[model samples]
Target: MGIVGYFLPMLICAAIPVQSLSRNAETALCQTQEMQGLCALSGKWRNQLQSEITITCKKGTIQGLYDSTVGNGAYDLVGKYLQVNETDYIVGWSVAYKNQHRDARSTASWTGVFYAAEDIIKTQWIRAAFKNPEDYWSTFTTNQDTFSRVQSHPCLHNNRN
Candidate 1:
């Protein structure tokens, strides 16, 4: 009976859900308007200067950067795009951090979508270009290279070079 008592607690724990409960909470939390945009991007992102970017979708302002400093930053879902004030050093584009070899590589651009009510802005660059091949290409390549590269792939595959 004493052994059964110890096993009973273990059995009860096994019966109760811990992972599921956490997942349910996470899903519910992420579904919130502020977090909705970041549901796919809530992670540790690092920049070339080894700057750490922690994106959380809670009740707070998601600040944008100018010269790596928050400047003229706005988190609003205005119209179809999430408009953040253009940063001096950032060139009005969001940089996606790629974690590789214990170092994060800053990608050319990221797709931004802001939620005003939630005071959250989400940015990510999963693929090369979201739209407008020419526009996305120029962000990463110079005029000469952009023209040449567009000639071959024409899809901006190697535009990141």
Candidate 2:
């Protein structure tokens, strides 16, 4: 191919700043995660622990409700839906159990991803128990869970259980 032909693509990319490219990518991600579309990452999901969470994704934010059978009850959740690059979409969220005083804070936090191919969210988390104001040691436990969508993705309508 001619040199102009080879450099045309490069020239086109160079015309757009790197920051602009990043913003465009984020916008595209939001489009896919919009509420109206059923492509992925917006639904009711349940884990093996019988914990159910209803997730909603939009504009790089994740908002939902989580209910744990073993915990007090249901709670509101807020998190991020991040696209670090072309191949990575990371999900992180927090459910705070208590917050009455400076040292009286308890929470469970999670970080994971939604696998588009299998439509499952595999995550690792830490559940931290509140400690006394002057305590040096804190009590916490770690665990992992795989969350499956309550309803199948549209593309896998009749193919998945």
In terms of TM-score, the best-performing candidate is 2
Worst 10 residues of 2 by lDDT: 152-161
Per residue, candidate 2 scores C-alpha lDDT tens digits across 1-161 of 78455334322332233345465453443343132332246557899988987765545766666778776666666688776555446888998864232333568889998776676889999888876767636578889989987743232221221
Give the lDDT of residue 44 in candidate 1: 30
Model 1 earns a TM-score of 0.23
lDDT, candidate 1, at 65: 20
TM-score versus the correct structure, for each prediction: 0.23, 0.62
Question: Residue pairs in steric clash, candidate 1?
Answer: none
Pairs of residues at least 3 apart in sequence or in different chains that clash in candidate 2: none
**CA lDDT, every model vs. true structure:** 0.29, 0.62
lDDT of 2: 0.62
Runs in model 1 deviating more than 4 A are 1-21, 39-42, 56-161
